[model samples]
Structure formats: structure tokens, C-alpha cells
Target: MADMNFTGPEPDLNELLAARPQLGLHAQDGLCLENVPLNAIADQYGTPVWVYGAQTMRARFAALRDAFAAETVPMHIHYAVKANDHLAILNLFHEQGAGADVVSIGEFLRATKAGIAARDIVYSGVGKSEAELETALSAGIGQINAESAEEVDMISAIAARLGVVANIALRMNPDVDAGTHAKITTGLAENKFGIAAADIPALYARASGLPGVRVAGIAMHIGSQILSTEPYRHAYGKGAEMVRALREAGQSVEVLDLGGGLGIGYQDGPGLSPAAFAAMVRQATNGLGVKLMMEPGRYLVGPAGLLLASVILRKQTGKRFLVLDAAMNDLMRPAMYEAWHGILPVDAAAFQGMATPADVVGPICESADQFAKDRILPDLRPGARVALLDAGAYGAVMSSAYNARPRAAAVLVDHGGFELITRRQEPEALWDGEIVPGA
Candidate 1:
């Protein structure tokens, strides 16, 4: 019930590295992700690149899986594709025995292309189009989360036309406040995410009667970057009550898709503990006897990555502005959600220097291109490099080519080395497929 807003004194470099165990600050070599120095990566890949620690991601998944296992709960983890949709990341999760939770046909296809089995993908989104639904049904995904009666009807019609039964779970809007950012909250009644909890019974009946629809269970996703389990306890409790009501009415319920929103510390703070979260799930849905599925996106990848950018130039008028080549187009969370990401110098010596307040900004024309305001960091010169910590999830995936700046490259670090997963967008490729109508 306390304010969920992130607030605290600025964490020093040691504190930042301590909170994120995957990052290490070497006395001479500088900051290293996993085992490879971030400077080495920036030197090779150039500035404004995304560097991910493969082992960190793997360990996070294991921790979550183990947490559920310890609670004696059978949980199927579907890595939320929208968080970071790079194929390499998806493939890594898939190889680790995780499924894919996707929102679009493109994501579904990307999951499959990443070697996730078609039956292991869960297609979820409020505005699924006819084409998207048809594609999902064609691929025979594990389940389609229906957000409305109209969506159920559409799925039924499409499945009937294709002569294939579509497995579905009604996404119930429990109207629970997840205590996250208002823009990211999806379970509120006003938000356009899921079906009303009151309408589920009748809609479940309708879905049962539909020829090509198979009612699997229920799903609820309150919001993203949720740092507490209280909202989930409330939402899952409501979902369990609904399942009991449905089963009492002689309807079969088998799956409970507890969509993920586990938050991570972007500022050396604690996030929702996986063990605590699993315990909440166990306590809430104890007697339900349904298979549990979680779609974790940020929790698994957020802390494992950082955005590497080089200082472009220092400008001082009334205030200091440390400009970088990266922009909001490269990492939009700050601009979009007013999010916070720890900025650390890539060089350990620089990080150890005297700290000063400055606005860390990007080359974008928009004023919102700023990464941090009045942020305290060691004085940085042009050509010096810095890393925006905890950007593995929403950073690169949400990037765009705004202001004619091409998207940055992405690299995965592991085994004392790194490999480029996505190359930096070439300037000419921006117009490769774009056409001038009159020309």
C-alpha cells in the first residue's frame, strides 16, 4: 500500500555493481559484463551498442524456475517476446526449455524461427487482427488469450473456417491496481486489455458452445514492472475464485496463465523476489489443481544487459549536458515512462573520478531525448564511454530510427568473449524498402 515509486539517494558505482552481480568493475580493465570488458565490446562494436550477458539471463531463468519448483508448483515459463524480441535472446530461452509469450504474428513467427515449438507459444494481445489470429491458429500455438467476447467469437469463426480447434483462455481484467506506472497498467477496468471479470461466466459458456473453440482456462496480467506481489496475490486470488465458480458450474478449467510483470532494480533497489512470488502463487491457487504458466520478460533479461554509449560532447550553459550519440530512439523507456537507468562510466578510472551533476542527453532533436536529469556522475569528456545499466529488456527492443539515427547493434557476452547478435543499422538501409510514391 506504500508508494511504489522508485526513490533513493544515488547509488555509487560499487553499489551498482554489487546489486547487479553480473557486472564487475576491474581496477585496470574497466567495467566488465560477465567476463568481457564493456570497453572491449564498445571498441569493437562502436558506440551506442547493446551488450547482454548470456550467463546472467540463463541464471535468472534458472532462479525463477527453481523458485517455482521449490514451492512444489508446476510452472511453465514463457519468455515475453515484447520485452526483448531479439532472435538470439529468444533462442537462448527456448534452448533453456522456456516457451514464448507473444503479442503479434511477427513475434509468434520470430518465436518459431528461434526454434520454439509451435505448441509452446502463447499468443496474447488485445487487438489481435483476423490475419494474426489466422496465423496463430495455423501454427497451432499453445493458447490464444481472448480479451473480449468479440475476440472469442472471431477466434471461433476463424477456427471453424479452418476446421481447427483453437485453444483459448479468457484474459480477465480483475480491475486490480498493480501499483505500477499508470500507462503500463493493463488490468484496471478502464484499460483496454482484458474481458470484464463479471462477463467471464457467460463468455465461457459462449466459448464452450462455439464449435472451434476450446476453453482451456483463465489469464490475467495486471501490469509491467510490478515490484510487489500484493497485486498478484489479489489478482490470482480473484482468478482462482473464478475458476472454482466455473468448475462448480460444470465447466472444465485446466490452465492459469499468470502473465508476468516482475520488476527489476534499475537503481540498486530490490525487485519482487521470485521465491516470495512463487509462495504467493502457491498460497493463492493451492487447491485449484491447474497448471500454472508465467510470462516473464523483464525479470529474466532486464538486469542482464546494458546500453553502451560514447560521450559526444559536453555543453554547458546554465546547466551541464553530457550528450551522447544514443538517443531516445535507441532506448525509449526514459522518454516514454520517465524510467530510471543507472549511468556508469565504462572506464573504471573515470568512474572513480570526481562526481558532478549533469543532464545525460542524446543527439535526438526532441527535448525528451534525455536519459537522465541532474544525474551525478564523474566528469566525462567527449569520446569517453558510459553504460546505461539494466537495459536488457525494454531498451533495444523498443528502439527506433528517429532523427535519421540508425538503431544500435546488439551483442551477447559469455565465456569470456562476446558476439554480435544484431549489427548496427546501416544508413542506406533506412530507405531500402521505403519508396517515394511519385518517384
Candidate 2:
């Protein structure tokens, strides 16, 4: 598994700024994303807000698409909706001719709401309720990646009931090590993600003869935060071999849904090169003659969004602690996966302050409600703001109202200005739908 932490000294503030060109230190204003200053948004909407750069996302999508095109690799890019499900974010990708890779009906609805055609969406998940399957089928979904034999049967039954031929793909458990964090890895034998490789042959044959289903192809997702292509080379090589074997058995294989887990640099470094990744993919599946599809979540949006937080207080305990109003409920990656995110001050003056070690934490009651431990950060006084970098993916969508702290507001920056995408949640709204024993 790839270690999420830096063994040596973390990159200095300027190094971090240099790595992400979208952000910069304004001479008079503060840290700016695109053209709007981070301090400006923080001052207006308050801290614990999310700000996403529209141009950053646009550039990233173009780079990924162009890399594949450069390698002469024909593939469809499905923006993974679970990363950041905000409608504005979805619409931005859709405008760039990207489809959606959804795992639930809610996400499917969000995609369609954002003007993504139903035919462009791919539904993938292990536990799709009957209602969810029916919804996707009725709405004319592009493909459904079935993870198990029972799910295949369930899809068949629902499709037959609806009188529609559901396009399906057998998700193969290639059991390849993605070399990512263990908690996010999904393709191993012990994980409950997909059908075992040994069992795919028999199941594929059986599903081929089933009613109300068209077996389009095979799909596999090894894991998330995958920084290298070695695992993909191994996994796709197995997938291509399976495609050949299935064809020899008189089964049709049309699409290869190479599930996405492309990683980004959380620290100040180029995490993964799109050109290298594309070249490796081209070599791995060189003459497969199958329609290719990839579902990239973090790679596209992770670097485009950031969490703006304010220093609540500086506690000088056994270890220096910089507590912010934002908690684990707002950004769970650190608490959940021990993830590393670049922490930089929003003020231009503070951006160049003397570095000192401090534990960046939140007000959440949990012991794990920390973002960085002993992180070298500038001297941020109480009320000073900082931007938690690379938070566009698996950041807000995974947020909750834990500790009854209202979910933070969100903003989208573009064209030298910013707009409020989601307003701060009102605390009373937390219990609005509750039934208090008929009181």
C-alpha cells in the first residue's frame, strides 16, 4: 500500500503553492484560487467553507482526455459522482463531455439533474436495492456493473419486469494489489467487492443465457488513491485475457470498464502523470478491440477544491494544537483514512511566516478529529484562516452533521469571481424531520 504521509520534511509553503498553479499569494489580498482571494470568501461566507476552481477542473478534464487521445487510446471518461456530488461540479464536468459513474440512485438523479444524459451514466455498486435497479433501468441507464451472481439475477428479474434489455457487465475481482491505502482497496480476494476471478467464467456463461440482460463486458476497480500503473497493467492484462477466453467460449465482450482510482499529490509533488498513466494503459490493453470506459473521481476534482478554515484558538498543551471550527464531520479523510492534505495560511503575509510544528485539529469530540499531526505550518493567530488543499474529492460528499455543527457553505470560483453554491446549513434544520414521540 502507498503510504499517505511524507517521511521527510513536508514541502514548504512556496513549494506547495508552486505545485498547485491555481493557487497563489496575492500581493495585497491573500491566498487566491483562480482570481478570487480565499480570505474574501472566508470573510463573506465565514470559515469552514469549500471553494472550487472551475478553470482548474476544466483544465484537468482536458489534460486527462488529451493524454488518452495522445496515446491513441479510445475511452469514455465517466466522472465519479461520489467524489463531489454538488450539482455545479457535476455540470462543469458534463460540459466537458464527460459522463457519470454513479453508485446509487441519488447520484444518478444528481447526474441527470445536471443535464448528463441517462445513456451516459454507468451504475456501479455492490448493494443496489430493487427499487434503485428499477429506477436506473426505467430511466434508460447506459450500463450496470453487477458485482455478484445474486445481483446479476436481481438485475435480470427487474429488467424483465420492466420489459427492457438491461446492459450489464460482470465486475471481476482480479485480486490485484492496487498499492493504495488498505482501507480503500476493493479488488482483493478477502474484500466483498466483486466476483472472484475463478468464478467469472461459469457465471459469465450462466448470465449470458439469462433473460432481459445483454452482457456488455467486464469491469474491475482495484482501489482508490492508486498512484502507480503497475497494478492496472496486471489487472487489465488479466481482463484482456478474460475477454479472449470469453470470446473463445462464444460470449460477447464489448466494453471494458476500467474502474478509476487515479491519485493526486496531497503533498507538494506531482502525484501521478496522466501521460505516463495513459501510456501504460495503452500498452496493457493494446489490441483488445473493446469499447473502453474509465470512472475517475479524485483525479479530476481533488486538486480543484479546498476547505477554508479559521483558527479557533492556539492551545499550548503537551503538543501545540491549532484547533479550527471545521471538524471531522466536514472533512472526514483525515479522521477516517489518516489522509495528508496541504495546510497553508490564507493571508499573504502569514504565507511566508516562520514554520513551526503544530497539530491541526477540529472541534469534533472524537479523538480522531485531526487533520495533520506535527505539521509544519506558519504562525496563524486566532481567527487567521487556512486552506486545506486538494479537498474536492471525498471531502464534502462524505460530510455529516456530527456534533451538530452545521455543514459549511460552499463556493465555486471562476471568471475572477465566486458564487455561493451551497449555503451554510442552519442548525435547526438538523432535526426538522424528526418525530419526537408525538410531542
Q: 187, model 2: CA deviation in Å?
A: 1.1
User: What are the C-alpha RMSDs, in order, of all predicted structures?
Assistant: 1.7, 1.4
lDDT of 2 by residue, 1-439 (tens): 1136345667888899999999988889989999789988988999899999999999999999999999999989999999999999999999999999999999999999999999999999999999999999999999999999999999999999999999999999999988777799998998989999889889999999999999999999999988888888999999999999999988899999999999888887687789999998899888889999999999999999999999999999887999998989999998888888888898888866788889999998898999988888877889999999999999999999998889999999999999999999999999889898968
lDDT of 2: 0.92
Listed in order, each prediction's TM-score against the native is 0.98, 0.98
Best by lDDT: 2
| Prediction 2 TM-score vs. true | 0.98
Give the per-residue lDDT digits (tens) of candidate 1, residues 1-439. 0124677577887787789888888988898999689888888989899999999999999999999999999999999999999999999999999999999999999999999998999999999999999988988888999999999999999999999999999999999999888888999999999999999999998799998999999999999999888999999999999999999999999999999999888788878899999999999999899989999999999999899999999999999999998899999988888888888898888866898889999988899888998888888999999999999998888888888888899999988899999989999998789888999
**lDDT of each structure?**
0.92, 0.92
- Model 1: residues with Cα > 4 Å off, grouped in runs: 1-4
For residue 193, what is the lDDT in candidate 2? 97
lDDT of 2 at 389: 93
